[model samples]
Every structure is written in C-alpha cells, then in structure tokens.
Target: MKNRHTPCTECRKQRRKCIQISPDQPCLRCQKLDKICARPENCALDPNNEVECLNQEVNELNQAIQRMEHELKTLGIKSPLYIKNNTMTLPRSTIENLFYNWKIKINNGYFTIDTGIKYISDLLPHYTSIEYLSPMTSYSSSSSEDSWSDGGSILIRFKSQEYGGFYGLTGKMLTKWIKKRMLGQQALLINHIPCGSRMLLDRLVDIYFNCHNLYCGWLHESSFRKRYSQLKEPLDDLICASLCCYVCATPCDHLDFNAYQRRDMCDYFYLKAKEKLVDQFDEPDKRLENICLDLRSEYEAAKVQTGIDYALFARHFSVAYCLRITLDCVVNKPITRQPIPFPVMNTLPDELEETKDFIRVMTWVNHLYEEPFVDMLVEQIHLILIGSTCTISFETVARMDQFLLDFGKNIPSEWRLCDNVFDEAKCRKALDQTTNPVAIHAFLHFAVLIVILYVTILQPVSVNDENDLLLQHIQRNALEKSLKMSRLLLYGVQRLFKLKTLSPCHVKLTSMIIMLYLVDPIVLQCSSPIKSSVLEAQKMFQKCLDIICNIRGIQREDTPPQLLAEKKDIKDFIHNGSVDIDYYDRFPDPWCALLHDVSQFFI
Candidate 1:
C-alpha cells in the first residue's frame, strides 16, 4: 500500500478522506463543514487520549502568547517611555506625586535653607525613637514609612536671628556699596573681552556641560545647547557668556590655556556679561553675579574697616547708613523672595520626559536653597563689622555660634553635615559623602564662616580687658572650634577638587582653610591629636593641589613668578611636612590678605 496523508478531524469523524489543495490550506472536507482542519492524530476520540490532546492544545496556546510578549518587550526596549516587568520605568503618577510633595514642602517653607531643627537631637535621633517595618501582615508598624509616603516629615521650628539687621545693611545697600567701592579698583575688575570665535565658544560650552553641569546641574544641557544654538534673545547670549566666564576662570588642560590666559578669557566674558546686565542689577534675577557680589562686599568692608579704627568706621558707617535709609528702603526686610522662574522647565520636549521633569524640579530646588543660603552668608559678613570695631563680645560669639549650628541643622538631608570632625571616621564620612556641587559650595562656605568667626574671637589682646580670664577661655574654645571646622573645610575642598568642581573662586576658599594650618599660632602650638589633624589637613591640601596641578598642567619653573612661588611653597610643605609660616604672612596671597583684614579685630 502507498503511504498517504492523514485525514482531518472532521473528515475522520465522518469516516471520509480529507482532501486539500496544499499543506498550508484547510482540507476540502473541513472547508465544506466550515470548521478547523485539525490533524488526524489530534482528533483522537479515545477516552485515554482526550487529556493528552487538551494538554497539547494548551501548550500551543501558551507558545503563541509568549511569542507576542517577546515582540512587545523588544518594542519596549526601543521606546523612550519603556515598561519592564509589567511596570513603567518611571511612572507618571510617581513623578507627579514627587513633584507635588516637593511643592508642598516649598510652600510650607519646610525645605527652606534657614529652617533648622527645633531640637539639635533631631539630626541624630536615638534608635528608640525610630519605627521599624513589621513582617508580612496587613499592617505596617513603621510610622516613618507612612510619614515618608504621605510626605509628612517632622517639622522643626527654630528662632530666626536678625541676620543683616545689626548695621541695617540691606542686600540693596550692600550691592550699592560693592559697586561704589569697586569703581576705581581696576585691577580687581573683570576685564573686557575684545572678541572670540564661535568654534572656541562652542568648545568652552561643551567643556562646561561635561565638567561643570555634571555636578552643578544649574543648566539643563540639552535645553542650553538648543537655546544657545538659536541665540534668539540677548538673555541667551548673556547666559552663554556667563557660562564661558565660569569655565575660563578654571584651568582646563583640554582648553590648553595657562592660568593667566584663562583669567584673561574669564575677565573678558565676565565684562561682556556685566555690560549687558548693567542696568538690571536691581532686578530680581538669580544672576550668579549677585551672590558673587556678597564676596566683593566682604572684601570692600574689610578694606575700609580695620583694627580699632574709629575714624574709618565712622566714615563708612555714615555712608552705609545714608545708603540704607535714603537709597534702599528694603534694608531691614527679610529676604523671602522666590527665585526667578526657570526658562526651560516648561519648554522642554517630551523625549526622556521623566528625566527632563526631574532636572526641572531639581534646578528649581537648587535655586530655592541658593537664595536663602546666600542671604545668610551676607548676614554673616555684615556681622563681621561688629568684630571689626573691637573684639567680638562673648554674647555675640555665642549667638554667632548658635547661628552657625542652626544653619548646619537646616541644610537638606542629602547635604546635611556632621558637625564634629575630630573623629577620623566622621572626617572620612564628610569627605566620602557626595552631593551636588552647589551643596559642596555651601559646605565650603559654612566651614569658612566658622573659621572666620572663631579666628575673629581668638584675636590678640592689646589692653587686657576685665574679662581676661573669660577671654583666655573663649580663645581656647575658639581655637578648638576653628581647628575642627578647618578640618571639615579641607575635606570639603578636597572633595570639590576631586570632583573637578573647584573654580578659582573656590581656590580662595581653599586658601583660607589652608591658612589656618599654615599660620594660626594656637593651632600651631597644639600637641599630638591636633598635630595629627594638621597632618591630615596637609595631606588633603596636597591632594587638592595635585588635582589642580593635574588639570592646569604640571608645575614648571617657566611658570609665572607668583604661580612658581606658590608651587615652591607647596613643594617645601610636602617635603619638610611644614610651611614657612612667616613667608605666607610677609607676602600673603590675595585670599590671605582678605582673611587677615577681615579678622584684624584683635583687642
């Protein structure tokens, strides 16, 4: 007998031969019956084979489902808003909720830079106060889980100190003071840039995105590039110019420019930006130059006010008072203004929508923190005037100390600092801890402020006051505080340098920290633990220098005299494990000079 194909289920049921035109087509008998042409083997009607047949059908169905799923997954991988494991990578609801919670916090001023914990213990809460998650029940025992879910963290209310109210110096008055005093200071002014190539400008902007924007995130990369390419408005040019200023101020080996070249380029860009914004200084814009002006004001204030100089104090005080009362009426008002609206927050396209949303929110959050933090810094500078007249009083010292402590407490959880740096582990924690560069800036500033305050308190006694014993005690305390804070400051600067986030402006801050170790007689006279701390600081400072050297290109004898001299000092310190302290005092760096002038209120 000749071999033949099997009959279909319907044909076999009828005991008829199944006829088909092709293997892929339905059998003629099944087509006539309007039924599926199942294979004859699958059509077995024996009771024993029934379950096997159903099982085969079920397996076939499962295979088909899997093939479809695989195709879907493949498509998902190509999609921007991909879903994985039956869930969105970043759900719209989740982003919306996070943004809502953040807004609530902002509206309540809960996340404000100046809002400290009501109790200091809140920073390091006891384990007993914490709630743990209970195992697999209908209920969770942890209140923290619910609190976090509901966006209801503990709210701490603390007393806000009169920051810039001591001398009635307003932000406006301070701005005027800087502009007025800076008029004839041609050497300090950012020089005008003649011109530049679009190619070079583009390269600098790229450098900014790769280096600065990674840590700062102040500029949304895609949005900035897009806007810059268009150059639709003067604001865009101004923004680009400012960004170039920042990049030029820092040495970039890739830029192949020496320190002087970079400085000149930075000055050029800065001057261009300044000319554009010359009329808008009083406007409420988060132009970085404004916060920068605080630094300049401190410099000018230090320049004008010196050790026990009543005549100089009277003259500037009168000028400042006149400016405050007549020219700037907002002198005594608290700085509660919101940051200028973000340009790209709403304008960004839908591609990588979740990431864009996050960037937008974080940019706003950074701005929110920056304003108050800068205000507090200005207040700290104004407070320096009190110390400038005479030795800072014990009450003033205590208040200032409390203010700093409170400020530390108020820092966001992600950026919060460990106050005690005496412990090696804590110092490492501070150094190892990572956050945004803006936070790093805040950390460095805070440390600098602490060092300045304590250094002011430890001034030499010219005529012994009645509080001589108390003075000695305060001096000892100030020395210890300054040492601890200086260590913290060095660790911060080291971190900043390591991140490639340190700018020339930050170099000034770094120098101030290093000066504490290089000079400061009280710190120098200390024993083992303090010596160890100083050694640790020296190592960190060396690390910062190494990073700077690496980026700016290696130190060379052919380097400028000033740069070479500084390099030699660093080399000597590295080899001898000590510095020529008198060498620093005799021919101080600009930062050291500013530091000396500011802290010149010795009794």
Candidate 2:
C-alpha cells in the first residue's frame, strides 16, 4: 500500500499534519473525531479550475452589486455623491441583510430614507451605501400609480388597459394589516365540555351526515376522523370548531333546548373557519390543496356511487353553506345597527357554474327531501337567476315565464281565489295562530315569488325596428294580461303583510314592498293611457312602504342610502310632473343588489 503524503481535509483546515497508515484508510485524527477522511489529491486542483472559480466568484460579486444599485434606484435614491459613496464593496450576506431590513421598514410604514439609513447602519456599519447619505428628499414613485392616505393605507391606481382606477392595498399589505387587526381575537371556548367526548362527537357526526351533508359535505369522513383523533393541542381547536358548527346547525326538536349554546358554538367556529380560509387564500402555492385533495377524493367516490357529476355541485354547496352559517351567526348577533342584505342574494357572479349547480341540486333535493325549506331555496334560486345582472336571452326569458305559468297552474283553485279576495283580518288571525314551520316557510316563498313576478311583468321589452302595428297591438295585449296578473299577485301580498306572518325585515318581504313601489312608476311612464287608478296606485304603494317600515322596526332613516337616494329622485320626478323611464334603467334592480350580497356563499 502507498503511503498518504497529503494531509486530510480536517488537518488542512486546522493547519496540522495528518498521520495515516495508508492512502485508502482514514487518518487517526479523523477516526477519533468520527469524520470521513478527505484527501487533497482527490480534489486534484488544476490551474484552469482556479481561474474558473475566481471568475464565478467575480461574476457573483458583480450581480450582487447590480442588485444593490437596482434596489437603491427603486427606493428613489439618485444623488451622485450618495451613489459614489454607497458603491463601496459589500459582502453578499451584508447586501442581502440591508435589502431585507429595507423591505421590513417599507412594509411597516417607516418610509423615511433617513430612518431607513439609520436602521441599515445599525445592521451593517461597515457596508454603508453612499446613496444613504444623499440629502435628496424626493423619491421616485412606484411605476404603478399609487397614493398613500393618512390612514396608512395605499391606494393603487390601475391603467385603463387594466381594471381602470382600481384602488386597493396590495395583497401582501392587506394580509399583513388584517393579521395585525386580528392579533388578539382568540377563538372563544363557550362550551366547557371536552370536544373529544365520544357521545358528542358521534351525535355531531350523525347530524352532519344526515342534515348538513347534502350542502357542506367537503370533509372526508374517514380521513377527518383519523386526523382528528391524532391532533394535539393547537390543531385540535380547528377540528373542534368545525365539528361544533355542524352540530350546532342541526335543527333541534325540543322547544326547551338551549338555543343560546348552539349560537355561541356556531359563532366561535365560524370566526375560526373564516380566519383559516383567509390565511389559506394568502398562501403562495398549494393553498388549501390538502383540503381540496380530500374533497376531490370524496367527490370521486360520490360519483361512482351516485352516477352523478357532483364535483362542481358539492364545491358550490360547501362554499354556500360556509357563507350561510357565517352570515346567520353574524345577523343573529348584529354587530351593527344597519340592516344587512338578505343572505340568499349575496352570491358572486364569478361562480356562474357553481350557482347553476346549486340551483340544479336544490331543484333535485326538493323532490327527494320534500323539505319545505329546500322548496323555498329552489324558488329563491329561480329569483336570483331571473334578477341576475348578466344579459338574459329571449329564450331564457321565455323559459322563466313558462316556469311561472307552470307554478301558477299548480296552486289550488281555492288558494288562487283567496289570493284575490281573502279577508285581511281573518288571514292575519290565522297566520298569527299557525304553528307549522313548513307552512310558514312555504307561504313566505310563495308570497315572495308572487311579488317578484309582479315586478318582472313591468320589465321593459325591446322591439325590432321592422316591427309593424300588428306586433305593437300584440305587445299591448300581453302587457294588459301581465298587469292583470300583477294585480292578482298584489292582493296576495297585501293579505300576507296584513297577517304579519313573515318578518318585514326579511329581504324577500322588503323586496316585495320595493317592487310594489316600482309598479306605479313603471305603469304611469308607459305609453298606455293613465287613468285615475294610476294616481290611487301610487298613494297605495306609499302607504304600503310606510306600514312595512313601521311594522318591521325599520325607520325611514334605516333605509339603504342608495334606495333613499332613488326614492328622493322618484319623488322629485312626481313633483315636477316628469316621467323618466330611463331613471329605472340607470339604477340596478333591487333584487339584483340583494342577490350580490349572498353570492359569496356559492363561490
């Protein structure tokens, strides 16, 4: 065996001689230290290797210098003296540290150059940039037009090529600010009972599977259980909150059951879920991937078992359920005195497929469950789709009209007659005494649909330029029929309102009153002859508004600012004897506004 003349790596690092028995074996010192013996000959340094290594290092240094200069330019530093002084040689690590500290200060609203300089100087005294000392007070603004308000919020202005004049803080800044706001907002443990209790867990799971599963069934039952059992202190909070929300949402049979406890549990868990969801949204990549994977697996299994593409359906259902639970908790709690829009109408337009899927599922579920609430939900979906801001084709309008006609045909002859000639006092007495939840829910949906139909009849129609007198006559006849239908529907609404069966604050009910108010203006502005009845109709609509506001605990002052503004314009038009049908077109339909409020649920 050849003797090892070259020292080992460790010995070379320590500047000591290495002793080895052979070239193949480790040195005694390396063996004692339990380190692998490395030989200098194994490296076999070449003249070209040294040159290449030096070049690489030099290139890295140049890149670092360029980055520093670019950063200085971005920070609005342009003084020649500062640039020359700051060009001092700095190690990569020191440059990196300075850049990081600079970013931290900017994010924290410490924007002054002098303060940044002081901070960086303390961080790296030996590697100060000459630009830091420049007395140039003015800095170059961001390429993206932005303005900082006194409130410490930055409003970014987008070009017309983008989403023009879009003003908001950057995503990162908004997330940081929100986190700072929610710093002390801890999830409250209202229930003293341990979450791991088997009895409670079983009951909650059963309730979830039985009732809430149809809509919010994203979590894989088996996987969730396995993960939940293994979770420790911190993570268990989310599990507990999620389970509790499901349990609390179950409809209880006992009249004496403590509703307050359920409310508290729902509230706490909703807050936790909302916070978690926001955090998931802010993640750079693989955001909510774990949850999505689980949901996908469940959906696949469901498709195999049910033979239906429930993937899109389930996603929307779960989202809507989450939003609904959160909104319900908030509405019941009422953090503010201002009236909140009805939760059903608050869906986002981006979730077009989701909304369609939700509606389809609701229609199917109504037949399967025969649940009054599900039926009501289907009707609400119908209203939302009809009132959608998206352009509706003639075919879609025809379909909607056909659906309404079909619905009308399904009503009992006696019920249809009662709608037009029912005794207001008797109806009121019966509604007050009615105890059936299903009946009350059904009536609410039915009445809302009637009112929506009434308003829909007044929607302006477009005529082709080539249409002759024949088409005009046909249109007039159709309009008269629609007016008759509206009058019949109005009678039903009056009876229902008089009975006080539904809350006036209920969005559907409030929207009905608004629709009625719109009817008079619409008819009066039409080319059709205005009789004395038009004046009476206007007086009656005002009376209805006054009554509903008084009954529903909504003061005139509590009305939405936009609605109030519109009402004032309408009043002014009446006073000036002017009829502007264009006024109605300018403002969004009230029903569409209501729909936008609840659209987040479907998303």
Candidate 3:
C-alpha cells in the first residue's frame, strides 16, 4: 500500500480519489464537477515533508522570539513571558503582567509606548485568531462551546483595546502636563533699573512716543507725560525700559542733539529697560495692560487729530507689545528651560478683532485720506501678517502675488533703488516741505514689508524639471530680478539704520534679511554668482547688525543660534570652498522659522 498526499476537501468529503496535476490547483475531478476545491488539512508533498515544514516554522518562530528578547535586553528591559510560551498557551496572567510592566516602563522613560502601541496595533490581524488556535482542555469548562482555545482570544481582545486606549490617554495627558508646566514657569516680567535723571527720562519718553508709538500708538503722549510727572524720584523700570526702546527706535533728527549722544542715551535706557522688564515685574502682563490702558485713554482723546482709529491702533499695538514682552522675558532663557506660559495665548482671539479693525481702518485710510503710501503700507503689513501666521493655500498665494504685483507698479522709483542714502537732515527737509510728512515713515514701513514679503513669498518658489525650460528660465530670471530688488531694498534699510532714521522695527527687519542672506534657496544654491551676491548682501547686513548691536549692546556672536549656525555655514563655504546647501533644504521654508524668531525681538 502506497502513501499519498491528502485529497482536496471536496474529494475527501465525497470519499473519492482526487486526481490533480498541481498542488495549488483544483483536483481534476472537482474541476470537472465545477465545485469549489481546497487542499485538505495537514497536506504536503509527502508525510515526512509535512513534519519538516512544521519544524522549520517552529524554528523560525523561536528565532523571532530570541531576536525580540535580545532587543529587550539591549534596552535594559526584561524579556516578556510570551517569548517563552512556545506551547502557545499565552496565559491570561502573563498577558496582564506584560501590559503592566509596559505601563511602568513607559512612565519611567525606559520606552515610549505610544510608537510601540501604534506599531503593534498596525501589525495585529483585523480578525481574532482564536478560531485558528488548537482547542485546549484548560478552557473547556467555559459555557460557550467555542471558548476552549486557551487565553489567546482574551489576550487579543485586551491588546487591541489596551493599545488604543493607552495611545489616546498618553497623548492627552502629555499635552496637559506640558501646558501645566508652561503655566508654572512663566517668565519674569520686569527687573531693576539703574537710577536716571528726569531730563533723560523725558527725552527717552519723547523718543518712545515719536518713533515707536507712531506705528503702535499703544501709549498716548499726553497720558505718558502726565504719568511721568506724577511718578516721584525714580520712575518704574518697566516704564523706563519701554521709554528706552522708544529712543532706540528714534532716528538722529528726531533727537534734539548729536548722533553720539542719541546712541549713548538709547543704549543706557535699553539696558535699564531690559534689566527691569526681565527681573523686576512678577506679573508683567497685568503691568503691561495697565500701561496700554493709560495709552489707550490718550489715543481716544487724540483720535480726531491723529487720523488713526483707536480700536485698530490699540489692538495691533497691544499685540506687538505683548509679543515684545514675551520675547524679552525669554531672551536669555535656555530652550529646554521650563516653558513660559504666554499670556498672549489667551488674547489670541483679539488678533481676529485686530484684523477686522485693520481692514476697517484701511478702508477709511484709502477712501478718506486717499494716501497711496499709507494705503500701500497698511495693505502690505496686513498681507505679511496674515501670510506669516496662517496656512496659506495655493490660491491664496496666487491672489497675494497678484495684489503685490499691482501695488509694486505704484512703488516710487527711489524706493526701488538705493540711490539716496537715508539722510536725517535730508529726510527732515523733505518732510518739512512736502504735504505728506509721513512719506519717509511710509517708505520705511514699505521697506520692512518688502523684506517680509521676500522671506514669505518670493524665495520659496521652485522650478521643477517637468516644467518648460523656457518657463523655468523665465522664473529663474524673475527670481534673480527679485533678489536684486530685495538687496536694493535692504540697502535702503541699512542706510536708514546707519543714519539712525528708522525704528526698532528695522532691527527686526534687518535680522530677517540676514537670515534670508544665510538660507535663501537662491543664495544657497551651488552657483558662484548667486553665492557671491549672498556674501555681498551679508557685508551690507553686517553693517546693519553692527549699528543695531551698538545701540542694543548685543554682539554679533550673541545673536540667535539659528543665525549663528548660518554664519558658520557661510564661513565654511568661504574657507573650504563648499557649503552644505542640503542642510538648509531640509527646512520647509528656512526663513519662516528665522522670521518667527526675529519677530519676537520686535512686537
């Protein structure tokens, strides 16, 4: 009697001899009868081969268990009990113990179970494997007739639920913990200020109102002056620091005397302000709100004369100040330092209100004032702010580009070129004669907006191989043209800063330009001409940085880590004739993060 492979299921049920040409195909009899056919259980090439296949499968399973145990040992974790359950009993107690250990180790920082949970959940079979398991006498006492497959059914169900629950719970709890920690570690609001004179205080406050307050107008001149007079001997450092920031932002002609005196006074006040803002006030937000209220009252009184809407001005200014205060509080703080609870986070809804007010005021400015420069400046600021903060779609980008292009046509030729260096005397003379005293101010504002637009818009455009080469060439040419225009705009900014004609806003703007010079995709491309242009732009930027650092007493080396990192890359390129352009390519938009970081330096 000869042994043979098992017959197909249909053939076996019928107790008929099955004839087949291939192992995987239907038997000849079943195919002829047009019946569905499947291979019989325990079927193989031969009796010995079936056992050999089972041994190989068991060996592979053991090897996998050993590998998992080795990995567990490497991570300093004890091997799980399931690895040793070769009999497939998978005890319910062992499964529970494994989960409990995982929970403990997860909290102990031994492992991050969230990723593991996701991995396990993804690897699990969609349907339960209980039906496939061999029947066992251990669970035979259960009431259900199909419930005698050991603990595999219970273990599978528990694993599915446990992993999903743990992933969700851990994520929520971790986020809650982080937010709570941030609230506890709020940055100090104010520090002590060195003693100063009433005259110097008055001068600083005047500068603050004239330069910083012109755009922000968060502080009213009359109310600020009255407060200055009412306060006894030494003024509060918060007020004093705010005053210093004002003077630091003021141009030379805005000062009564010489540039040297102006710079010296600005520096003195800046340090005092930083010390007070960083060290003194425990509840900076409350103090800042009080200050803004006083200014708001003043803004209401002079709203008719200033031709600026109080609600719009106050909201925008307050947001800027809030950001400024937050940045100052964390400036010298470490990145891994306890999170500082942002007071402004609660007031974020006010930003929407501010946006609405801006649109309303902008309509008034355009319709009533009919001032193109003012309209353009407001529009540019609106677009830049929106673009920087939001997730813009392709349609929004296209619309914004069209809007800017239309506005660009109206930009004064002098604004496009760096033909005239910003001269305080010349600026004052021009303002004194012209009907629009705010022309230079508007131009400076426009310059800052252009730099922002460059960072947020132009630099990010790419040319793909699938695109028409001619179209690509056209885009590259346009990019080169825009890069030149950006450099020229930056040149105007540097001149303004050099002459002390711009505000602290220019410091933020120049810092952004420096960032762009470092990582702008066009500049960072592996091309000589573009790289040389970037280096030239850096020299101009260094001048701007020097002037800002001189007033703020911040050294170039003391700049933010992101900027410093870019500087090193540039240095490496200059020395070794190579730079890691790919490092910058990793960023979605490298300048976006840089802009965000630099914006903190301002309001």
Best by lDDT: 1
Which is superior by TM-score, 2 or 3?
Answer: 3
After TM-score superposition, the amount by which residue 545's alpha carbon in candidate 1 deviates from its true location, in angstroms, is 7.1
Residue-level lDDT of model 2, residues 246-354, one tens digit each, is 5554333211224444545555556765656544533446456745844653443432322122444444444454344333322322111111111121222333332
Please report, as a residue range, the 10-residue window in candidate 2 with the lowest summed lDDT.
Answer: 158-167
Residue-wise C-alpha lDDT for candidate 1, range 72-146, written one tens digit per residue: 656655554333223423446654643354321222112232323322223223221121111121233445321
User: Which scores greater on lDDT, model 1 or model 2?
Assistant: 1
- Ranking the candidates on TM-score from highest down gives 1, 3, 2
> How far in Å is the alpha carbon of 478 misplaced in model 3?
5.1
Candidate 1 ranges with C-alpha deviation above 4 Å: 1-195, 220-223, 232-236, 278-387, 390-393, 399-412, 417-425, 429-445, 460-465, 495-603
Our tally of clashes for model 2 stands at 16
The lDDT ranking, best first, is: 1, 3, 2
Best by TM-score: 1
